[model samples]
Target: MSRELNNTLYQSKSEHNDQELAEHQETNKRLQRLGQEVLKLEAKAVNSLAERIGDNFSRACRHILSCTGRVIVTGMGKSGHIGSKIAATLASTGTPAFFVHPGEASHGDLGMITGADVVLALSNSGETHELNAILPRLRRLGVPLISLTGNPDSTLAREATVHIDIQVEKEACPLGLAPTSSTTASLAMGDALAIALLDARGFTAEDFARSHPGGRLGRRLLLHIEDVMQTGDKVPQVTPGTLLREALLEISHKGLGMTAVVDSTQQVLGIFTDGDLRRALDQGIDVHTTEIATVMTQAPQTAPPHLLAAEAAERMERHRINALLITAEDGRLIGALNMHDLLQAGVV
Candidate 1:
């Protein structure tokens, strides 16, 4: 409790805290180094695949491309996980494919495979018994078998119509027991195959959108201005002879912050927006006395209802506008949409 004793105890605590901090910093450095090493190893494994893309890769792609039925991907354990993702990528990219469990295939799921189909089997060692069990049936069915394996001499590779060697120099795991680098290599190869098939088949963004209709990309690519535009009475509009106050009322009722100044024939003459109202007010123009035509912007930018909503969003951003009028080919106002509608539809 004396001053000297208290000072000595404080010094000891400070030294201990410094030691803990130093240890924490050293541990962080070790962790960062380990992560970097794993990334480098996996990247190298994937890069090595570039050299393996030869006759066998082309053969595998050709077999899948020629198949009348879907590509049935089958594997076990980590390979199975990779196979499933590969199948999904293939299916979404214009090569119809799906994953089937190897163990389940032996238990009657093998019926899924047909003569018209192509089999893509994944196994690091090329000796997965479950995968091999169905090979004879696949062969009997006269289906093309594409095998991806580390060992070209293994049974699956030998039986395959086309073999792609996915061997990695070493696993990212320091113990070299886990399937880290090997699985990464397999995934990379699968992606390469899917992209090649996509390119060969002339798969387009619209086709991709069709497969992913629930995604943001699908909405942006597939949704049209007519699909999200405010139609009928929902669109704000006013005649050129209408008072600014009446146009403001229409704008407020529609909640679009703007209204089209249309002629009696429903042709858009101009557009009056909240910005226009502000400018008019700044110039001391009376809303009740002013005609909307005098304050409206003539020949305002308009889009066709058939235009992609994504394209509309881009146009709005480029022009620094928040709303657009949808017009018919004959220049009549058909509908209207604001940025909020695009946001709600997930096009922006």
Candidate 2:
């Protein structure tokens, strides 16, 4: 009887493991199928924009470009979240833009919009009550309205100076209640407008970098050699006639892994790095007595102070080097930097 009881317990545990495995597989299958459906619907919505981006998109870009003041973006609900992101993108991409809540705009926030500013309103359903409530006020202020909506005949659409129809075939939601494809379409439309204006204004990466000074791209684009390079006493430098042993001491003192071989006028003539020391040792050169000019690499690559830190990184990468000397246009060594400096500056 005891043996039978143990056998029963063993069978129960085995069955439970099998059941858990089957449940996990089923859950994974359901998640994958749902993900695929959502992606397909969203892609279809965005692709549909190809056909709709005609004269109206051009007009929106042209009007926004011609506006002397900032672009004021406003929306309600989920549209507001997307509107905020769109406004940020526009602002970063050379179009000055900011988002205001439609509900707030109905209050004293209406004062934020002026005649010089262009209003870009987002509403999947063009008749959002909060947005419609402020249309007359916007009109009174003489602000041009650009509407992004699914219902072109709705109040907001009809009231807009330029109506952009962002209608999607259907939402990815199984119940057709929550916004999915419509919001994706609106966000993509906003990106399209921002990029159009970016190209129209000839916005360069330098301009974008200036606006994003705290970001990694900004560090790379805006940081110059003069900003991070070591100068004055921090530079490990030696005259051409300096002994190799003494130059090694300078390299050790500066901790830059290298030293510049310069002339009397502080003009860089060559460079000696840790690697050069290794080769000198292998070739049986006497470090105590050898002149650095005899062993150092002549006519070493140099950079100007104004060269971007990212460009300096590229130079280091291309040459398989780890250090660079910052020079003036006339070949005077002004500063020095290494791979560690670029890393510390977040340029690499």
Candidate 3:
């Protein structure tokens, strides 16, 4: 469902908005206090983390970077949930990583372990039984282990080659049992580690786009005119000296509302659009005998075939044109893209 539809699904639309407004006022006070608490705790956690980054964090990064196999991140409960997202972020950002559920690790899933891998364990107390249970076997197999916890002196942290402290003062939850600030701090630390590796590897936006090829940003970054433009026989074009009426026929046949006027070498000369036709009719121009170049817009905006489809879309919008001719570096017409092409490709 759309975000708007999903939001409306649970919201009360009755005339009791005044009562809801009063409740919102109370909630705002609690939220304002909670937001400040979270910020303060996060600042403290990150500051401590900077001190802990000295020697162990560097060793951890080197271990993860040199691993022949994937980085296995594991935690329990709320930490497990955050670890899953952290693993995904790391993997998509160029680090080969995946989450192994701690509970499942104690089961036959332990077979997924390998000697060439690095294990990253997360626990606020640094004593999660399920995670610590399999650490012995990983060590036996010579797998490097890194632990992130609030208690750096705990058993799991002591056993790890590196330990990252993610201690927080209090939970946002009224009851301290809930994992609130700690989980946020842990997730942020994971992001910092993943992004550090991303920068170390020189991972570019285009590389990230390849990992998210189905999303809009991916399309904007990865898609070229060659992917979205009409090419070969689909392009509607006429020689520069062709009759305006002939060019109009091609435009009508192609149904792109425009035609490219090109030379014998296919170098784009100009463009004749529906807007041009309207102006021509107002000027009482003779379409039958008049050359297309006489009425076409001179040096109409052209984009390189390798240009991003999103950029081509922007160019069309900037020039107030509905279509763009795709040319090579030498101005040879190779393709054509209309607004509809961009829309269909989600470049708009």
Q: Which ten residues in a row have the lowest lDDT in candidate 1?
A: 131-140
Candidate 1 residue 77 Cα shift, in angstroms, is 0.2
Least accurate stretch of 10 residues (summed lDDT) in model 3? 6-15
Tell me how candidate 2 scores on lDDT.
0.94
lDDT of 3: 0.87
C-alpha RMSD in Å of predicted model 2 compared with the true structure: 1.4
User: Which scores greater on lDDT, model 1 or model 3?
Assistant: 1
Q: Candidate 3: lDDT of 89? A: 98
**Predicted candidate 2 versus true structure: per-residue lDDT over 1-348, tens digit per residue:** 699999999999999999999999999999999999999999999999889999988888888999999999999999999999999999999999999999998779988888899999999999999999999898888888999999999999999999999999999998999999999999999999999899999999989999999999999989998999999999999998999999999999999999998889988899999899999999999989999999999888899989998999999999999999889989999899999999999999
In model 2, which range of ten residues has the least summed lDDT? 105-114
- TM-score of each model, paired residue for residue: 0.98, 0.96, 0.86
Pick the winner on lDDT between candidates 1 and 2.
1
Q: Candidate 2 vs candidate 3: which has greater lDDT?
A: 2
- The number of clashing residue pairs in model 2 is 0
Which pairs clash in model 1? none
Q: Which lDDT value does model 3 have at 206?
A: 95
Candidate 1, residues 1-348, lDDT tens digits: the string is: 899999999999999999999999999999999999999999999999999999999999999989999999999999999999999999999999999999999898998888899999999999999998888798889999999999999999999999999999999999999999999999999999999999999999999999999999999889999999999999999999999888888999999989998999899999998888889999999989999989999999899999999999999999999999999999999999999999999888
Instruction: Give the clashing pairs for model 3.
Output: none
Candidate 1 accuracy as TM-score: 0.98
Best-to-worst ranking by TM-score: 1, 2, 3
